[model samples]
Target: MFYFFSLDFSLVVGIFLFFLFIFFFFLFIYFFFFSKLVIMDWEIMSFNGFDIKFTFLFDWVSLSFVSIVLFISTSVIFFSFYYMMGDVFMFRFIFLVFLFVVSMLVVILVPNLIALLLGWDGLGLVSFCLVIYYQNFKSLVSGMITVLANRVGDVMILLSIGWMVSIGGWNYFFFDNFFCCFWVMFCVCLAGMTKSAQFPFCSWLPAAMAAPTPVSALVHSSTLVTAGVHLILRFWLFLSNYSVVVVFLFFVSSVTMFLSGFSALFETDLKKIIALSTLSQLSVMLFAISNGFCLFGLFHLYTHALFKALLFLCAGTIIHCFSHVQDFRSLGFCWSKIPFVMTFMNFSNLALCGFPFLGGFYSKDLVLESFFFSSWSIFFFLFLFFSTVFTVAYSVRLTLYSMFFMEKGFVVDNESDSEFFVVFPIFLLGLGSIFGGSFFFFLFFVDFSEFLLTSFFLKILIFSFFFWGSLLALWLVFMDFSFDKKVFINYFFYYGSSMWNLQFIFSQFFLNFPFFLSFYYLYKLDRGYLELFGGKGILFVFSWLGNFFHYISFKSVLYFFSFLFFFMIFMFI
Candidate 1:
């Protein structure tokens, strides 16, 4: 088992993943163009009315997503070779990371609810282990938050499974009861929302930055977080039937996007800022899905995964080179030290802002254009508009603070980017960030000419927000307002930085309340009443009864002897 932890093992896994990516990429093309097929129910056995099968789904969606996952996993594992060097538990770390990837694959390729649970639970369990990899208090707490938030989703999925059992079997794809579909969709939406960190579940996404940078690059960017999006997409047919669910999802996603973007603008912790950015982008995916653009949402998912992974990898390089300084405030004038990483980071940041012709542009622009075409109310329009602007604002803020601004801070003289393991994956993902969007857009939508035929004015309206946000952020960042001195401004900063006190709510209400409730139960029930009445009470009653019986037995025996003697004398007489 230890042998699996070596660098050579990583090389082997990377090569295998690359091969799988190639195979699945072509498979996706074939399925998309030539034929669509699903291979189901490689049966194991049958219970009363339920059949357990290792059901595998192989359609264009699964194929394309699998290809992308394998590609990113390959890059991440290779990057980890250099990123996690000389670690004492390198073996355990590698094993857990691989397990994480496999779990994601299982979630992607299975349609059976029971089979999905296997993968779903695998993802939650393995993620908890990975998040707490550092074995510190902070990581443990973060891991707990991350896992518990996801466990809600797991419970929802389990409920959905039970609900599906009422219809016939665990196969959700073949569910026929329209009434049952609504309940399943509701449970699924809750599950997806939790896994994707929508709205109230949003705190864990930023907290999960406690994991190692490579884990963040993989888990946050593509695998763990996106599992929810993928799950919802699988249930899109059911979800589309319920306009109520779609409307609710739209509002939740919009709030999540706005909140995350707002929070990132004030976040100084570099990785948390990126994590918030990820949350915001995830909200964008959910937004598109909720607006009845499943394919568009999926397109964004693929594009975002590419560039976002690139961003995280670039951020990881920056953190690694600087002796793990993760605060953007302490990382000023970074370009002079690490120009390559800064360049890629800026590329990804621009892509994240949906710069024209970049990877994010293809999907993001379409999602916005489609929304504009819809007849939704003006409030949501502005919510989405400001959210997009906030994305650019934070991207510009991060790029300027880290690369251009001059501030007095510690600088590591030994920073180097010469390693092949590190540079190769970054370069690979960089190229993907540059062109992957257009490539996927072409494949996904051969002719988006209908959406493209909108007026030039409408087209430019979306891109214009990029400039507006960048200029706004630029002015704010470069100006000397002494903004912190003012009470109103200070309060705004505090609210923005704290996710509008959502963190406090999650920590106090969600996390602490459960712990306090459990402790109370332990005292009042387990230790107090249950102990007295359950085990101890039973033992005392048994002991007392035994003593009483032992004493009474001697007296009864003497009485019985005297009675027997009298009876025998009477009989003899």
Candidate 2:
């Protein structure tokens, strides 16, 4: 039933994504570990003072990041075989997935701003199409929100392109020596946030759970949302030259990390919680970019994608089996329903929490170690430290609340993976989530000096945050801690759950006002006022004048004039 088109085509494309992943991985290993480096450029336009070109700067950063994207996309496509096995429009969905991957590749490959927009806008457009694939009210609304939010980024990119004219061309790297164009880089960073779903643009990420799970796996995990961090990393050369932009980016990203992490704690819906987790991880990448560790950010991005995509897929597997039970409150004892899914879920959540030797461990540890040595402020360290703790807290809470307890709606089903298409892809990704970090760590960081350089206390403190956070979560959930009334009653929890009223401001206040204005103009001006004054009123005046002219014809006027003239002449005589 799924084969609207040739299944062979899907298999070929899926294999290709994996092939590209391996190809890039080998290339990255040679470049970073060995002596050979591959820096290829394709020029398209040459003009006054600058040329518009497509340049793939295949340093450790781009290659590694793109490898991660391709790897995750490959797995997502494989997972989709089971997820959409019987869907009528499976062909359309796969096509969109392929297109989305292509667009992301465009974003990843290009260094020029104008050329980059081709991919950037492509990601936005394709993501919108994918999000509304379900064609329901929720999907339509979510897709509209996604499009409008991404449009802000799309518009900013166009503005960035316009601003680049002052710098001679869209090739930002060419201006490395004369890096005074903060505004240009600033525009790019601003655009990045919208794509990355930072802060104000964040509501769309969770709302986009309305999309199919495979789309979520690709869109949230690696391709669409990561475009922002990828763009910022590409522009890091210019961004690092300006402290103001860095400060602004740092502030925004730190708050985003905290906010999303906090919000995940409040979220009950399984998919939405996973979506918020993606937001937090995206923020971490943004924060790393702001600190001028763009390469380090890229490393985290790579590792995060490995696990987060798997997490989404695992959630999809369970959601598929359960059908409608996405709420953790009612989804208790999932460990009983599918022990294997429970295993995948726990591993992913643990990876997300940066458990030792997992995919997240290597990158998260490096990023944290780097932060301590960077000599940033104590408050900065605190915010970051606590954000990590928040990650652990919520991850633990999610696991315990969903797995450890037995609720009224709990079901116990022992389903084997013999017929499940997800098993292979999930197992492959699970392997990546465990070993990809260590594997990439060799290609990523040459100097392990940073790891040993930090003080023992600082390292302990970092791990302590995770330990304490996890313990507190266990206490809160398992101890009958009255989490619902106590936390929900508090302002922070309430605010966090409501996503800090950001939805209210965006959806109700900002969005509604524009809609109100549009309605008023459509009804009051175009239909009513304009119809009366511009269309109907003008027609009425012309018709009345025509009638008046018709009543007094030209010949009748002449006869009346002649009679009046004769009468006047007789009177005068």
Candidate 3:
């Protein structure tokens, strides 16, 4: 009470951001030592065999992930300054971005189940809000789907939490009880899948492109999508023991990778293409985790974040400079017009394709080598190879289509001025995309090596996938093949492009069924039976009783007394 003074919120935020930058930036540097440790613990409450606490683990895993998240988030915020410039609700937008960052940090750092759920929900809630921030019908629909998909994961987590109470609090690290652990593992993996947009849950991700591009850069890259990967990484210890769950995750991850790759190959919107690519990458991470190489999975998450963010930012610039044009067919060659955007876009795409020595090369190459060495079925091995090859194929296919092709006399939209604030962030992430993975590998994999059971032929086989995929992509581009009639040609084309009609299935089961049941209950139960018995039927019975007891007349009283006296005489005799 000695002094009344308050710090402005802006100043407080600036200070917080500055502190995080310095602390984590240094942690990023120092983590090369790989001295993992548990750093902090604080008890929040205790009662009746229930315990809750705030604790954090500082390991190479968390440090690496958190560092990248912080770095990408900062870049996104800077880019938003330009993307969201002159908007009336700019402050609200910025605030929501900050909330997203903080919640994601919670997801990354916490070791306890209860605390993790808080972050998980916060990420979902904030992302849904961001998705619908434009307040348009499309955005609303997209946001609803996104939120509902995430809510499925939230319910699974909640069920796990409820089960946790019986086992004493929300610490799942020491989850020894078999029944509890089994169900928890199953639910947790499903929750992770939904958050990561695996398989049937994949629709909402492309739809979430309705949000501003800056939000897309952050959400798709470092925050929302990666949260699922981080959750699985956190539970890797427990997950390793359950072979059934592992097998399930493996197959699911493989299918997701292939479907997303196939879908991305056919996608047209520039941002949607990047979103689908991000979906494919998430599947790659899950596949790595499922294969018991979680270290590599976490590594890929880090590397993917850098380039994926750059890809989105570059897309944002392209779309922004063209007055928000996203249709691939309408775009013209822009290398001469905006050298920076085109250069960085190609760099990110190259990295995405696992170009030699780039960011994606280290993790993806290692994953491929791992897959080659593992004793998987021919189907999995082939799909894994196809997914990897398709990653390159689509990267090449999309880049060449968008930036290298131009029809003469084509009119183009230009807003190079809007690229001013946007280009800087793209440039920064582009640098990371070029060198971030190699840097992490240098430090983290100081002694990294593997012994695959093969000769020169097998080694060449791995490298040949990339080359053949590029050749295929170039062939398609050169042929100028546009399969506009594919949908009409067969039902397979329609089903594949429409994500195997998963949206219809999800809508019917989760939405229409519930609505139908709600209508039935309201009409038949609430209004019909409940109303008849509990409402009108009770009132009629009371009214009839009142009429029977009505009138205290002398004749009525005498009749009642004579009936009672006759009954008493019959009983006594």
| 1-573: candidate 3 lDDT, tens digit per residue | 111111133234434664686688688667647564665777789999665679887776787778788788767877776677657677777788889989988888887788888899999999999999999999987898899889999999998888787766676656865567888988999999999999889888988999999899999888998888888888878888899999999999999899888776666688888998999999999998888888789878889999999998888877776667887666767776677788888989988988889999888877777786677989898888888787888788887877787733344444553464566667778888999999878876777464234567776887898898898678656544555635443454466556667767774357777768999999999998998899888998999877765643333988678767888999999
* Steric clash pairs (candidate 1): none
The segments of candidate 1 whose C-alpha lies over 4 angstroms from its true place after superposition are 1-5, 46-50, 407-409, 413-415, 448-450, 478-484, 517-573
Root-mean-square deviation of each candidate, in angstroms?
A: 6.3, 5.8, 8.0
Superposed model 3: Cα runs more than 4 Å off: 1-19, 31-34, 45-52, 177-179, 407-420, 449-454, 478-493, 513-573
Taking all chains together, each candidate's TM-score versus the true structure is 0.89, 0.86, 0.84
Per-residue alpha-carbon lDDT of candidate 1 for residues 13-50, written as tens digits (9 for 90 to 100): 78888898999999999999987987877878988967
Task: Give the least accurate 10-residue stretch of model 1, judged by summed lDDT.
Answer: 475-484
Against the true structure, whose lDDT is highest?
Answer: 1
- What 10-residue stretch in candidate 2 is worst by lDDT? 410-419
- Residue 66 displacement in candidate 1 (angstroms): 0.5
Model 2 quality (TM-score):
0.86
Model 2 bad stretches (over 4 Å):
1-8, 34-54, 177-180, 407-416, 450-452, 475-492, 522-573
